[model samples]
Target: MSDTEGVEAEVAGAEAYAEAVDVLGPFNGPVLLAPVTHNPNNGVTDGVWDVTAGDRAAVLKVLTRSKGTTGHWAASDDPRHWNYWRREADVHVSGLAQLWRPYGIRAPRLLACVERPDGDVALWLERVRGGPGTRWTVRQHVEHLRRLGVAQGAVGETADRPWLSRRFLREYIAGMTPGQELLDDDEAWRQPLVREHFPAGLRHDMVRLHHDRDWFLQIMESLPRAFCHLDMWPANVRSDGPGSALFDWAFAGDGALGEDLGNYLPDSVFDLFVPAARLPRYAAAAYEAYLHGLRESGWKGDEHLVRLAVCASAVKYDWLTGMMLARAGEAQVDYGGDRPVSPELRYRERGSTLAFLAGWASEARDLAPRLGFPEAPSGR
Candidate 1:
């Protein structure tokens, strides 16, 4: 199949430049639309662009889909799979984006938008000029967490919006059973790197989690829910601005308290965007800052529940760990042609990622007893 078939290419228009001017109103100079790739580790759901209209520059994003990416995903696994294609447009047009903008939980400003009769979407968004999220220092990340807590917490569960993220974990995993997919092939984890890196207790913890995920998922739902930037990894965030500038609202939704930081704490290292050693300080900074922000936003829920929710939410990545270990040797990271990541380095990185995931799973198991949730019997 050609590259243009998926949702990302749906708006690869011959007249995207003209459409931008026509929809957004007159500009002094000719508008040119150039296709570009922004951060797409999640999925290529949008055809992004750098649009130059005379002297003024802006970005044009057109939502697109490719079955190659979605071939494994069943609509039943995530009912919103089709509907979320228009989530960004929904956020802007619904005025929820505007509601969160001033609290410093801003996204790129929306200039204009269009909804095609065929159910496609195009957005004219302000080009945010800032540094990527990976470069932020611990203090900076703490403040980012603080501002994120305040901004999103300010909205809390009070946004009264139905389209906000719901069942994000199930929706995101599509149809793959992370535990079944991994445990079915124990030999895959026997690969040298995983065998060497995965801790014994953690492995035992993960196996038990596979069979008893429902209770843990229930625990996650019990926590106070609010709007969460579901894809808050370093690649999807920028910290160069005075505060955080979030993007990619496709995965934005109702999530348990502290869930975004669950991903935030481990992903920079998981993707090897930053060194693994920094994770401790980064996580420390994030939790404290977020709690402070939660209070700043007047959240009065039990702090202990938030802490429990953080570890419980690790359920989201249970399958991801197994899947990563099962497929151990794919060259997943692209270096923008600057340099190739040596296979040994990649192997080590993946091993480290598995180890980190194991720790989170173990935390879930360990935290359960404390939270009065029964521990699942070990599969070992």
Candidate 2:
């Protein structure tokens, strides 16, 4: 038989095949289950599976956290206050996705959810059939961003949910600041591989952002805040028949006006789902689309501030890349999907990621004259 048949046969024979059997009941036939590709984040060991249960095919997201795992803003590994998994379950159960169905945004149907006392949960969700946002073209990505902006722009503001992390960007970036694990790992930057990975035009700015803890916090917080899919990357989004579906609500909360695009613009390339060279094209498209969406949704806001926010928000990579450098022991920068740099996941894609991060710096520096934020001379 062909390779496809061989893999199917292997999947049929493997005992790993029957994970949620107890939870999902007997399938209509031999259950076809395979691991869904996802990036590893700060919190848990996630086993997101695609299972064909009888006539129905669904996604089984198995979330687990160990005693040693810690919880932070977006890293909701801890079950108690930082209920990332529970929040997602609640979002589906509460019919929040339906509210956005008209806005071209949607979430998967929650089929079954099992929560144990030990802070572990298993979510069986409807395998939203269609293309993932990662596969969308630059124009598609822009349209989706516009729809997202209109959707979120319409949301305006509201009373805070206690479950929502109040200062998400603040807390998420805190751990990687000076005197933190990120700066402590700066010595690793001395390595030629790690050093060479970044462009010379960017090295000083990258380091500046790393140590300038106060600026990152200040600018991100000062922007026009709104409810957003804090994690707006392609992997967490999918394109439905004519609509779109966004998943992974763990990071859905208040964010800068255009912060989601910051995630979207860079990540479309960072995930290596989009061609690296086209990243700038995607970034420009997404930016204009998002602004158009905001305007269409009746947002009477300052374009300059929004632009500044988008640029500053790009600093999201400051801590992330530093973490990769710190953790990358004397190894070749293969640019594969490993924890520290796993988000980029491809050698060819690394430059795009670095350029995007640097773009944020340069753009932000250019916007500072308009933003009126404090001046820290960027050694251009």
Candidate 3:
């Protein structure tokens, strides 16, 4: 009836076609179609296969171009745009998959890649051996964070200058700005909370915090560079029994040792906004665990620095929510959520989070003194 309906019908038919034939390769006859299911995790398009050929009953995956609304920046076949989602999928399925194998990192094994007649690319991958609903407990999350730290450090040990650098931050800051109109309505309710509590200045120095070129360089040079999973959140990762494995290598690149760990902490814990009830205690435990893991992994950098970075990371997202709200009037697909976070709520939560960081930073100031680690000497 419509474009959306047409796409959905095509997808449904494709699912049927995928199921009809044996999709697993090393086949007898011409391998045609395979049974495939749509992955629920990604708003983007992905194809999952349940293979019946092998005795072990393996799974396969094919990442495809998503047939989404034509506004947002996403992976597409368009040559005019910079991002080629299908091609990037191929690089990840091919390059990073092999690079991390020796380090005991768990991820799907790349099987093969194919190009369809329509000039689209598909990546065939070994199904990560797990099911849905593998909810992560705090301890499990800690363990996963440690593994991510390990991955970062391991990559850092050999490689140099991983991808999450000052350049990346500056680009992120510039690119993240959305239309000002999106922030006009509901933000009136929320913007005050942020402005009242947190530091909201647009000075060169503040934006510089988003991309401390020197800081990024120092962190990269100071730490061992290993295979860093740029997006190391829960959805992109899974646990198979006792071991944890990460998927989604689309953002994998070289970077600092603790960068991955720092990224993982805030992201995994605060999916949207941290509930006020769970802030202090949860943050304390998570911070302690991170510090302990870092020390064990031979990290010599100040844990406080990592903490600062993580705190700053939260603010960046808060800014992002504001930017997205500024675009709400448009008919674009709202990936943030459908419930509609008013600008007031966004500002309040962000302000509270910033207040929390300032409080933590204050404690950090006194912490060194209490521990008798060192003190700022009075020169004047």
Candidate 4:
């Protein structure tokens, strides 16, 4: 069956629920299933459901190769593709997700990974109960970053897995087509939120950041490599017992030593989980804590190189400002929903984040020459 048809049938079928029970097992009563709302913009995910049978509970996630309505959301059959549709299932079935247990972080336990008669793959996972990362205090956020450092440091320069994503930053960034014309359009920038939060100076820096994208990518490639959870961010993590439980292994793959921390710090503020005002304080503390974790794991790399990678990693979001500008005239929505939100609030929060990332771009330029990668002649 085609992915679209399969998804429609599975969501309406009793067979899917029965299959869940068969895979999850030992239920005292019939399972109750309820559809869980998730980000609908991503085309590959068929559906997520909350499954419960008496005292037992699990999360059921269905994955498919559906392209949805946009070229950017298309999934790939290639194992190395950044959005390979089967990567998450493979991570669970092969127990690769559990590899970081010794370092105090782990993916939720996989109760079952079922290949359905249709094209979709169903994953039944443990329902971890804890405060979401969005609600985490600064101290908790730093500790999680430390644990992430320990885990990635321990996996330093390991043999590549065919199913693990490769060149993720480059490939993912290439998929975005942010509106360049909107960047310089005075009318677009004059939107109330943009005018107030994204000033002329910050806008120029962001444009420079976009211009230096290729240069930043080159520097990141030259840095020390590690196995990374490329989507490490507030929404995908939670406090679970003594350690943390990370979700969404779809983008797990190879990355520079400090890339995950780079992504995490900005992401925390981008979604307004942590306020943009705390970014500087969090950046300093998190970097130090991450380095401490790396040292604990016997990684003796130069601190400056790691710092370079962390700062240069801002290239991953170079398209964000233009994208935001393109959408500035539209009715704004909350991060995870279609619910209408005030454009003023949305732009204010994300504009601050863009300003911070623009600073990282400047820092990356300074750090590059010191590390022997001289700045390329600017095309701008």
Per-residue lDDT for 316 in model 2? 74
Answer with 1 or 2, whichever has the higher TM-score: 1
Q: Comparing candidate 3 with candidate 4, which one achieves the higher lDDT? A: 4
* Candidate 4 backbone collisions, by pair: none
**How many angstroms is residue 45 displaced in model 2 relative to the true structure, after the best TM-score fit?**
5.0
- Model 1 over residues 1-380: C-alpha lDDT tens digits? 00111223223345675676675667775566565545443343555676766666677777644313443431122325523556667777776665666677677778888765544577878766677666656676677778877876677764546556677775555455544666646687687756765555556656666666776687777777877777777666665357667776766667887888777776666656666666666677788888888899887777777877777766766676677676565654443222356555555665555556666666767776876777755655
Worst 10 residues of 2 by lDDT: 1-10
Model 3 stretches astray by more than 4 angstroms: 1-72, 76-95, 98-104, 129-134, 157-166, 179-226, 269-276, 298-315, 324-380
Q: Candidate 2 — which residues are off by over 4 angstroms?
A: 1-27, 30-32, 40-42, 65-85, 117-119, 177-197, 327-348, 366-369, 376-380
- For TM-score, the strongest prediction is 4
**Compared with the true structure, what per-residue lDDT tens digits does model 2 show for residues 268-305?**
67556687777776778888888898899898888888
Cα distance off (Å), candidate 3, residue 314:
4.2
Candidate 1: deviation at residue 194, Å?
2.8
Candidate 4, position 379, lDDT: 43
- Per-model lDDT: 0.64, 0.65, 0.45, 0.81
Ranking by TM-score: 4, 1, 2, 3
Q: Which candidate achieves the best lDDT against the true structure?
A: 4
State the number of backbone clashes in model 3: 20
lDDT of 4 by residue, 224-315 (tens): 88888899888788798878998888888889999999999998887777888888999899999999999889888898999998999999
